[model samples]
Target: MACPLKNPLFFLLFMFLPFPTTAQTYRNISLGSSFNALQDNNSSLLSPSGEFAFGFREIAKDGFLLAIWFDKIPNQTIVWSANGDNLVPKGSKVELTIDGEFMLNGKRIRNTEFVGIGVAYASMLDTGNFVLANRNSSIVWESFSYPTDTILPSQTLNQNGILYARYTATNYSTGRFLLSLQPDGNLVLATTRFPQITPNYVYWSVKNPNIGFRFIFNESGFMYVTSKNESLLSTISSNTVSMQDFYQRATLEYDGVFRHYVYPKSTSSSAQRWPKDWSTSSSPFVPPNICTSFMESTGGGACGLNSFCTIEDQGPTCQCPNGYSFIDPEDERRGCKQNFAPQSCGETSKEETDVFQFQELNNANCWGGDYALFEGVPED
Candidate 1:
């Protein structure tokens, strides 16, 4: 008897049998003239390599931000956000109308020159760029053009571009720090509390005469400032060859530190560690000690108003001056307040006089210059 497996009729029957297909590893969202509701259960646009995803990411309790992040990472590493300041409810949806109008939570989000020209679809590119395109596939708007706190490789930050720090690691709201390419061809990092009354508190700057009008972070973990003619004026690099293969992001952290972080492509949870490759070096020739040099007032510095910063092994630590106690014990950065009563302005009696004395604090320098200029005066 001939084996059934060797029979042509049996082979033909087996070849035609149906098999269960595996689900797709990633999902692609194609948008047209309708609203695409990106809920926790439903839809998202993944990059071709499945490395990055674009969708509504929960930032706070019932609050979500339209963001792009590393999908495979243990904790979502958001690179760019559309509405950092204006977070919408969890059930909010992003709609792209036929007229090229983009809406978030029923409000128009972006106004593009291609409005009324008919936008075909939106896609998330492998480079971490989320784009809206016209019928001819020309770009209308992209997330790379309006970055939040982080800058991915191959992205250019021009004179008009700004990287605004987030409030905290968990809070996606706008923070006190900002990094901008100035019109004078300088890259400056500034802190602002009230823009109406005070100017930006500039703590870090690249003020070279040959500084370029734009800055670019390349795939090899190198950042370059290039002129209009494409000549490289300055370059910042990590000089690590392994960094080129991983996903990298440079972020202006909320604490006013600009750092470069690298994520391995194939990392197990046991071996996973966010490796900081490079950073905009702080002044005073110490790593992250620049916070001590910045003026502390009602608006500026890492330790907040009336607090002095000191470098600790764990990082910067804020403390109050002598004779003063922290206004908020829970938050030392809120600064300190006088615990004793001030001397009366018009106390003339010698017995009832209040004397003022100075106490020296060791290893402490005032945030701003310590101005002690005084005209001589003798009281009876």
Candidate 2:
């Protein structure tokens, strides 16, 4: 059976593609192009094939973020974003000026080359890359070089390239976890203190003996690291899906898992080999088990403080311990707070003896380190 996504008109071709296409049919957004954050029907610059879009997205009412997303998808899933921590108001605008400067409301931005030829025009490529080119039509600046939490197919992360998870599923601010390809030629996943770039603890890592250069998610949907000679060093994920028939993205999720996901382009709900939604069919997810694997002694463990972690199908689930309630009900990863006042053992007054009772919790393990170790058993 043929896939519906194989039909170009069903997914790619539009009657009015808007911009003038180049020789390769890729649309080059000319200078003097501007998009107001007010978000109308024609606010974005679309890729030639209509597979991706580059524009401002409304994250909340009256709040917008400059973002790139899958254009044809029903939900328009965002792949990369700028200003997640600092969302702009309705009046903001993104434009390429007449003098060849990429400006976002009077501030120079997304200029990858500091000393090279100035920006002449921008193009949103079918590969989901938003690029700025010289007058000679050579690409000088691109979005692939500055990825957020996700990396699309054909994208490569060089040494020191890092992806920080969003604060939460919906909140795109920087989060507690990060995946980095270190300068020492090692790819590692670690927990980091919020608002701090320093790593708290490394939970997952793969070292290369011959020096790893780039971590690539190729067009075939395989993710791997290669040496300087382009020789295969290590396979991060060997799962191969048809990149032609589906949109692929490997994201370091908010839950601290680097997962590979594919969204089928068929538009038909009845799929034989893939699910109708974003499917994690053959993903070689990192850490394998985060609940038991993560051991960040400095801050909270994988599940935060005053909570115990259990693995769920989605990811690690954090549960507040008895006599403790979560500090924030909306976000469990923020940790829990004590429900009752604390009291030292045998410190109750004579009149309060009946009211004061020890809350005996079985298996009260001292995880995340707060107390000193003893050589012998304590006296009862």
Candidate 3:
């Protein structure tokens, strides 16, 4: 027998129960709450719109990247990451403890500048910013202040802000290129010495008379460098993509090209044909010709050593010459090695050198390559 206690007060009490919004799917994480790797249910915290997520993504079989990614997209495009250089193994945990201490595997996050008195809660906002707030509902720490390779709408980078590109598209470790908003008010794109933090050459830069103080990406999809008073000093990307209908992000891609991309929330728009996948917007490529502009004598050429670089519609492509092959086909950026054996210098006389022919590659020349010019040549 079921005993039903249906009273007038009980009927009224149901009116105020909280319900989820149509698009908003996430909830605030209270203090002392946590999630760990390998557990799908407790692992990720999604944004209010369910469009962005922050959690442990398994980058490898036993390796996980504590990162933020686009949740609704099929590609699961990663935007920002914490441990790109050092991937933590499975079972690692992140918690905002009961004592208001935020920690990852019981260790404080590096480079975090905490503000306010005490943290009470954490929330993943629809704008793609994860924030920690105190009892008074004031933000104490936020992910926007510490970005990785990508920046979403409404994010600002103060002077000295930097975006380091990943090694290869698949390999997420620090790579060959970086975009730096220098402390002295210069925004430059430069190549880095491999395996080192030293900047090698400036391939592109914004030269302005008035000093620039900050870099801003507004919600309307416009990017700009502003003065100390927040006046627009120069426009970096002026293209506009509405935030209401599209998910947007600008990234310093592994290929060393800084570009903006847009993902439609629904099917193709009436105004234009949008691809189901992410597509580049109205803004042009930062350094238009990578194969041509990336000729630095100090380091490997645009692609890598002993490799030829070609420009494709999507991006740059690297290929090995006739005699050379990629050292690591899995990673084309590792350069190339000769597949054929070299002739012994002692055995090969000046007359024997005639047997060896130089393969002429049409319209291709190696920049910064050592060469010896001959006065006269016989047509053989």
Candidate 4:
């Protein structure tokens, strides 16, 4: 009934956050004890909270440029792009000067203006957005606008215009993913090569105004949507859970899937209310494996769909479920094997030993197993 992601206490918590310290003199940027604002070199930097920082980075193969990152949170998510396409060359000299602009290895360039409105110095607000401000204290840029993979509540996914591009899968150099609002109000993700409408990949949607907006991602990697208005939360039909509300947050997952989630701010911590209660009408879809977690590779390195891999879990240990199975016992990237075995029911005897117990598990496909029930024994 209550909103979970919007922490009312966030305002007081950010007031005492540590500031960043660096050689470059900043007019408005604050430094923290444990951050490097600029990543490539230590000369420029920010703190850990993703509040404020600056540094040089190389984009593509040809350009080297000075960059800034929010150092306020543990994720240190980069919300802005100073020079997305334009980059400076690697190994070439450039230094961010004290007045606000960086000098190309001490050589002043024509474009010397460094400050923008709405951008702030590592100030975490009640909203999760970390804003960076200029000397006048106006937000020039924010972490919410140029999102890498995740989006927050109150953030609009525009359909009329091309809002985002897929940076490289791992390199972040810009891949082919496009996230935009559709003319019909549904949000979509498509490759530049494929422009046709595809239903399998539609990320999120907004059906009506009555549903209050809340999308949240959990620590376990599940995203959910919920209504913020208490009244609407009760009246909303069960089928609307899968329906994307007007206010929704989606992630352009690394595995090339656009997963939409409800954005709800916690009233206490940075956590959000999640595992969205799905709609009764709309069909719920399962998220891709990549969105669920990150896979670590051994000496063999980065495996593809064809490579075989195994995941160790508490329940089944290593066996894949009903719909899928193991490819190679030794490899994980070759992907999974499909189980064509048709599902059928076998008659059970009426004896006490034959009365089977029914069990429902979250995210589990319910493989083969035997069940036992007792009159008074407590179930775990």
What TM-score would every model get versus the actual structure? 0.74, 0.84, 0.85, 0.38
- Against the true structure, candidate 4 has what lDDT? 0.36
Q: Which parts of model 2 have CA positions greater than 4 angstroms off?
A: 1-26, 39-42, 110-116, 267-271, 346-366, 370-380
lDDT (0 to 1) per candidate: 0.61, 0.73, 0.72, 0.36
Model 4 per-residue lDDT tens digits across residues 46-81: 434324445555455555544444343333334334
Q: Residue 248's C-alpha lDDT in candidate 1?
A: 70
Clashes of each: 0, 0, 0, 81
lDDT score for residue 378 of model 2:
33
Report how far off residue 296 is in candidate 1 (Å). Answer: 7.9
User: What RMSD does model 2 have?
Assistant: 9.9
RMSD of each: 16.9, 9.9, 15.5, 17.0
lDDT by residue (1-380, candidate 3, tens digit) is 00111111110000012222122345577776766777342367688778888888887667788888898888889888878888778888877777666677887665543542487777888888888888777888888888888889999888888888888887677888888888888888887766675566778888654488888989988989998987888898887777777788888888788888887876546324676677774555577656666655534566667777766567767788788888898777667788987765465466667667777666565666422122233343
Model 4 quality (TM-score):
0.38
Predictions ranked by lDDT, top down?
Answer: 2, 3, 1, 4
Give, for candidate 1, the lowest lDDT window spanning 10 residues: 6-15
Tens digit per residue, CA lDDT, model 2, 230-332: 9999998887677657788989988788888888886444345676677775666787666666544445666666666655566667777667888898778
Q: What is the Cα root-mean-square deviation between model 3 and the actual structure?
A: 15.5
Error of 3 at 1 (Å): 86
Distance from true location, Cα of 272 in model 4, Å: 18
Q: Which stretches of candidate 4 lie over 4 Å from their true place?
A: 1-27, 30-40, 47-54, 58-80, 84-86, 91-136, 152-167, 194-250, 259-380
